[model samples]
Target: MQGDQASVIGGAIEFIKEMQQLFHSLERKKKRRRSLSPTPSPKPPSLAAGELAAFCRSAAADVEAKISGSNVMLKTLSKRIPGQVVRIVAVLERQAFEILHLNISTVEDTVLYSFVIKIGLQCQLSVEELALEVQHSFSQESAF
Candidate 1:
């Protein structure tokens, strides 16, 4: 169990380091692109209020579904999961918009799409990892 904990901690630290490096690399690229482009880049279209609401609803439903299907989640956490997911999605959407605005001028459409997809996947994995960690912690406490 101690070994497992150490491995998990080490993996998380590595993940964080990699993410930091990625962000720094992206920042450098953004600066290079901005310097090369003299004209103002067109702003990426923001999601309409209705569209955002629809997205939130869909995300909440997904969370609810996962909670109902998963035995690992505590009852208390399950109740809050949908709301938390909506908030997480909202924040992610805002960050993605900012990233798009910053890089749209210089980055190819395919590259931007890939970047967004990667971020989304990473966020999902992070959330799942967190949930498992919480469940593990609670289970260990209950065993005491």
Candidate 2:
């Protein structure tokens, strides 16, 4: 009975050591993951963001007015502005695909881009030359 008791005590000590090692390993992995994690993203713009939203809506309305006044249906186009990438989709014959994908870094780039796209829709400039022509034309405008 004494020998059996010694063996049982030794087994418990080994079990406890294993548990401690497991806990230590888990803690090390957690610390490694934390250190490798990316910097936190900025907090999203607050309710004051609505001011920018309203301005965008107004600009969209102006563009809508321009397209609607002509034969083109502006409603058929969809836009996705995700961060610095601007994607414009146009549907034709029941199919939809992106027509414009512009990477813009500032409000000015977006504003100028909108003007370029609007003029491209109205003119004979080839797809290859449209961007340059639009930039040149917008640059010539006094309001810009």
Instruction: Give the per-residue Cα lDDT of candidate 2 at 107.
Output: 26
Candidates in order have lDDT scores of 0.31, 0.29
Candidate 2 on 1-144: residue-level lDDT in tens?
Answer: 999999899977964663454345335434644699654422222323212111112212112111212222121111223321112222111122223322221221222122112333335433323222222322232331
- Candidate 2 ranges beyond 4 A from true positions: 37-144
Q: How accurate is candidate 1 locally (lDDT)?
A: 0.31
TM-score of each: 0.28, 0.26
Show pairs that collide, candidate 2: none
lDDT: which candidate is best? Answer: 1
lDDT of 1 by residue, 70-116 (tens): 21111111222313423433444543321221111112311110112
Q: What is the lDDT of residue 84 in candidate 2?
A: 14
Mind sharing the TM-score for model 1?
Answer: 0.28
